[model samples]
Target: MTAARVGVVTFPGTLDDQDAARAVRLAGGEAVPLWHADHDLKGVDAVFLPGGFSYGDYLRCGAISRFAPLMDELIPAARAGLPVLGTCNGFQILCEAHLLPGALTRNASLHYVCRDQRVAVESASTAWTGDFTVGQEIVLPVKHGEGRYVASEETLDALEANGQIVFRYAGGNPNGAMRDIAGISNEAGNVVGLMPHPEHAVEDLVGAPSTDGRGFFTSILSKLVNA
Candidate 1:
């Protein structure tokens, strides 16, 4: 079978598309570079919206990015069962696109936070998280200011009931996200959005002792390969 082609989108000011592409290649998939202005998805099997200060984080991290021409097709494609993973600023785009729920606000401390953080896998049902066991702990890096996630009590309750909360900070909360929520998934589980930088943790030589983040890429690749 041909290797699954994973599209990594690069918007103006995007900082991690290259890293995401490298991780995709390392996971045995083809990395297809996607421009923000392109209308086509280029026949990729899956897509990743990498973290970055797109549009220089002008109005908000992903506010401007959500309106990009590519998203006009990408959003519908994702809703049609195409696997889409959004990290950090990408996560912000997901929220902005309404593909995922909740809004990210400035950190409670009012400062940009960057660090190696521990997060518990709250669910293993998503395309990007199937390799992890429920309650598994993984280390990844998170860098952002408007990383704190907030929602109404009703929405929080709905997310908890549906098991859409995918990851939670295992130790102390880094950005004061409500209930330590670090990541979440859509109801179908094909789309996932997280505040951490998994691409940064894929290499053993560069990141923490364990290559926990590699599972995210491998999990999606395995799913596509099996399908």
Candidate 2:
């Protein structure tokens, strides 16, 4: 099978670009490196916005990266049904770019948090989450200072009504996100944003041995293959 070319975009301050690329390779996809400043998406089958304090998180996390030249193409591609995954700070960029709804804010405790967290798959229909059954639990490393997800009550209700909530923190909430939400997908299921670093958990030797994060990459690959 020809591997799907998955683009891992690197912004000015991106910290997880290489890890994200490795994850894509582990998932049997061709990992394509992309630059934030580039206007082209390189004709990749999928895109991943890795985590980091882009633009030094000036004013806000992902606030500046949203204006990068790549985003001009990415935003339209995402809206046109291209698959895009955003992790942690990347999630912030998606929200800032308006690709995904809701806003990520400082942790209620105002602390930079790092831990292995569990999240339940609330919906399996998205392009990035089809590998897990609904309600499946996955453990992954989460390290961030501002990971709390918030939205207006009306938007919250709409997300629930439309079944857009893709993942919810299990057991206990780590960041005080509304409803313990850890991830979400757009109505089209092509775009997803989450706060956990699934790319970091793909291997057993370096990080968690549970292999919870591998499914994230595999799921997306499977979806692309089957499509």
Candidate 3:
């Protein structure tokens, strides 16, 4: 079988591109590097927008990145059912692009947070979470100053009703995000965005005791293979 090719996008100030690519490779997939200024996607099977302070987080996180040339191609592809996973600032970008609902704002304490966070998988049917079981608990690192997820009441209701709320912070709400939403997926379930850094936790040798993050990459591989 041919290895599924997953693209890891690198925008200026993107800190986690290499890690995301490595995660893909470790998951038995080919990792394709993508640049924010580039307009092409290299025909990859899936796309990952890793955590970062793109454009230096100047005009709000992911505000400028939403207009990157790379997004022009990515947005359409995602809407057309290409699997897309956005982590941390990437999560902010998805919302800025309107591909995913809600916005990430400053942490309620107005401080940067870095910790291993516990999250419950609320929806395992999405492309990036198929390896997880619904109600499963996993630990992933969360590092960001603006990771608070917020949305309109109507949107939150719709997400809950449609099972689009993919992950919720467990134990405690680290960012004070509304309803403890750590991650969410689109109505079609192909596009997902989250504040946790799964790529950073893919390997046990990297100081992450658990390889819970590997599932995100492997889940996509399974989806591609099955499709």
Go through the candidates in order and give the clash count of each: 0, 0, 0
127-223, model 3: which lDDT tens digit per residue?
A: 9999999999999999999999999999999999999999999999998999999999999999999999999888879837577999999999999
Candidate 1's residue-wise lDDT over 146-203, tens digit each? 9999989999999999999999998879999998999999999999999999999999
Clashing pairs in 1: none
Ranking by lDDT: 3, 1, 2
* 62-166 per-residue lDDT for model 2 (tens digits): 999999999999999999999999999999999999999999999999999998998999999999988889988888888999999999999999999999999
Q: How far is candidate 2 from the true structure (C-alpha RMSD, Å)?
A: 0.8
**Residue 27, candidate 1: how far off, in angstroms?**
0.6
Q: What is the C-alpha RMSD of each candidate to the true structure, in Å?
A: 0.7, 0.8, 0.7
lDDT (CA) per prediction: 0.95, 0.93, 0.95
**Model 2, runs deviating above 4 Å:** none
Off by over 4 Å in 3: none
Worst 10 residues of 3 by lDDT: 202-211
